[model samples]
Target: MNVNHSNITITESACKIADEICLPDTYLPRVVVIGGGFAGLALVEKLKHKEVQVVLIDKNNFHQFQPLFYQVATSALEPDSIVFPFRKQINGYKNVLFRLAEVEEIQPSTNTIITNKGNVHFDYLVLATGTTTNFFGMDSVESHSLGMKDIRDSLNIRHMMLQNLEQAAITCDDKERDALTNFVIVGGGPAGVEMAGALAEFCKYILPKDYPEYPSSIMNIYLIEAVGELLGAMSDKASSKTLKYLKDLKVKVLFNESVSDYDGSLVTTKSGKTILAKNLIWTAGVKGQFPKGIDEKHVVRGNRLKTNFFLMVEGYKNIFAIGDIAALISKDTPKGHPQVAQAAIQQGKWLGNSLLKIIKDKPVKPFEYKDKGSLATVGKRKAVADLGKFKFAGYFAWLLWSIVHLLSISGFRNRLMVGFNWAVSYFTYEKSNRLIIRNFKPKSLVNETEE
Candidate 1:
């Protein structure tokens, strides 16, 4: 028989069904949220005291603060500062249960989710699975290049970065060392820009001290973008200023060019130019990630799950899609809302309220996204922002960026730790921690990209 809340007696089979069988029966309608990302966490927070029985499941048990992932990669912040334990996050919620399991498929017809651990039935199913790195079928680039989508991805880049330098320091061969020192970054979104800037700062301040044997000139940083501009989603002010800031930092900005291919060593662009680098970071694009079973009709651009105005998956009564995974296509939002933390947080809270109305038999309101604005920080004391009408960059924007990011970080201790790290770096022109805690070996992009 299939496993479910109805079967209170624990199973002794190999799949460890006992892990879930112990959950106290609340006798309330079960709501299964697949993902512990911003949206899923927000939803669970709202459903905490509500009548619903919330089952929050994710491959990882923590709620990772994604916006700061680049910081983690650059070693400006550690992993623990960004990853909050799901159990601790929902400490007091007696109605909610947390599970760490990889979902294999969603059998909507039977109202069941099949995971590696077991099968779970749900009265309402929420897919806040978020997005995965998109290579757009570039076999070579996907295989050779690095992507930073989560904590694991960030740590991979971090370890590889220091490891490459360490390897270069010991290697006698010139070509190999040059390849190690050369850094090529694809995509000029917040991730790429921030990474490029952080790398530039490292090259300027940290690398010189860390590796005095290698000349600062030997280390080169390149920020390549396909479009003629960077920060394509923001205003002209941000785009123009950031480009100038990057140029000031000595980061080679390649505009109107896209990486055509990479063969583990050489990076060739569409313009026929080539760069030799061992470290190739691809922050180019991302597509929605979800388990199998959803039909193509409900899938749209960027491989996102299509939902109605109310955030419900089209043609499914109890299934809802939200956050980066959800593409709420409308005349106003042709391509769907920008896949940012704001969109996810808003949609999650909105859906949570809507669900309360659902259980209370009240009117369900449609979701409408409010674009707060966008912010991207470049080198030290350099940043840009675009509010609805006001567009600003430089010192004040930089200050705002620091404050906003610190506040937005998950925990008080995290914010304090990050702040302390920043202060030390600024005052000393040095970073205290830069360790290859884990030896990073690149994973199979084919298997890793999808999850």
Candidate 2:
């Protein structure tokens, strides 16, 4: 295959090892980036058309807008509106190439990465594999409940909610109906808060029109947090306002409680409280995910790679880590940087700009992270923002959240779709098509069936 860009043409040749992944022969330094998340993509953008040959490898073919995942889960937006294709993102960037493969291991000694497809050698390897849902050793909850880590998780939640509603309508037993209608969202972070708010909105508006057999009051929306507050990362005022917004929407907020076990229908809390609910969305926490091969000594809490000020993995020369997976341990940032998109983007851009200098043995300054503020929305027209000294919540904050997220999306078409959906929902409380395209089964049940 021949890939052309401007005056450059890359042609694949049979000049590599028989088991090696095919790539066009190039004398330039090969920089292989694993995981096409925010940081990886940003680095690729900076390295495009530069001296290095950039190769981006990811398990998925698209970049998902994670902040809007709650909207997708609650059927407020379609999946495609929030996801952009990787190939589309790198359309004209000739120096950058995207490969779809799950990296399994990294042989740092050989400067090579082994993927499910084949092995690929790199001059400099970047680990931006990001994070996965952290169940914290709870096998029951992990298998029974859904997580909000990926686009597929959102779809699964949607289908499960819809299917449960349908089942609730058909069941003659009141207890079974209640279990089917109740929703228990774990964690008090932005994802869980937004998800609870959206579910409350759905129970208010959509449920009445779509399923009129039972009253909207039949659906119970519950937000369970281990702490006494919501949006613990935000200001106290923001947390109070978010709680108020959720209360106004008739959501039951359970503070100072965490889930101990979930058996597909019953959610038992650590405080000995139990709630019957088939739909449980776990947004509690996330731990770093990367290919095996790094030394255990360099791995920190949350399974993140310990890095120096330059974002280079500790004790490694050519291997680096970025995004959520990189923990730059310092006295100021003892827990590393916040696992947010802005932090990841800044790290990527900084590394991208400084990488070439480092490669040439030139002096480069350490990475400095700038706090860009935080924003989280509850339901429609209700959000909280903390922009330095300016802390506020309400319609203006919601508008800012909408604008920021809409513009942050990768493709212009995706932005348009999301904006249009928001506009329509603003006027009429209508959501996108809630079509149950496939059957969603719990992980444990699926495993049992497969076995």
Q: How many residue pairs clash per model?
A: 0, 0
How does residue 62 of candidate 2 score in lDDT? 95
RMSD after CA superposition, every candidate = 4.2, 2.2
| lDDT by residue for model 1 (116-143), tens | 8877888999999999999899988888
- Runs of candidate 1 exceeding 4 Å displacement: 1-22, 444-451
Clashes of 1: 0
Q: Each prediction's Cα lDDT score? A: 0.87, 0.93
TM-score of 2: 0.97
Least accurate stretch of 10 residues (summed lDDT) in model 1? 1-10
TM-score of candidate 1 versus the correct structure, residues matched by position: 0.93
Query: Could you tell me every candidate's TM-score relative to the true structure?
Result: 0.93, 0.97
Clashing pairs for model 2 are none
Task: Tell me the lDDT of candidate 2.
Answer: 0.93
